[model samples]
Target: MDRKGWVMRAVEALRLATFKEIQRYLDEEGEPFSKKELLDTLKALVAEGLLEEKEGVYRPARKKGSAEAFRRLFGD
Candidate 1:
């Protein structure tokens, strides 16, 4: 998939997004979006390697390293 798709997937998987949850996030954000845009974005993210599937569940792949440093330094 393209880079935009990859980025979206990374965000989704990192966030462990379900389809409906992702849709709801977009919806409740109070911005306007067409359903097609949301779904297509998700499908593209799935095409990228940012998400992993386990037992029918999808979550963002864990980045290797320490969040401890990040947390101490930047407070996320």
Candidate 2:
């Protein structure tokens, strides 16, 4: 998957995470993205309404019907 997709997966798996935590999760998944790359992807996801951020923490956006998209992307 691409950087955005990987970042989204990291957020989904973590539920709620700070930047360092998300980076660590990516590293643990063998996807060692640079800090800038991860940050940029996170910003894009938030902008696209796929993710949400507050107080430097990130999570998958809890939009209505968004779970279907998540299921399609990541399965049950």
In terms of lDDT, which candidate is strongest? 2
Model 1 per-residue lDDT tens digits across residues 1-76: 6534543544564476565665565556554346686656555655765565555355776664587658857897
Worst 10 residues of 1 by lDDT: 2-11
Task: Give per-candidate clash totals.
Answer: 2, 0
- Cα RMSDs, all models: 8.2, 5.8
Each candidate's TM vs. the true structure? 0.47, 0.82
lDDT for each residue of candidate 2 in 7-64, tens digit (9 for 90 to 100): 9888999999999999999999999999888889999999988998999999898866
Query: Which portions of model 1 miss their true places by more than 4 Å?
Result: 1-14, 53-57, 64-76
Note the residue pairs that clash in candidate 1: 13-60, 14-60
The deviation in Å at residue 65 for candidate 2 is 4.0
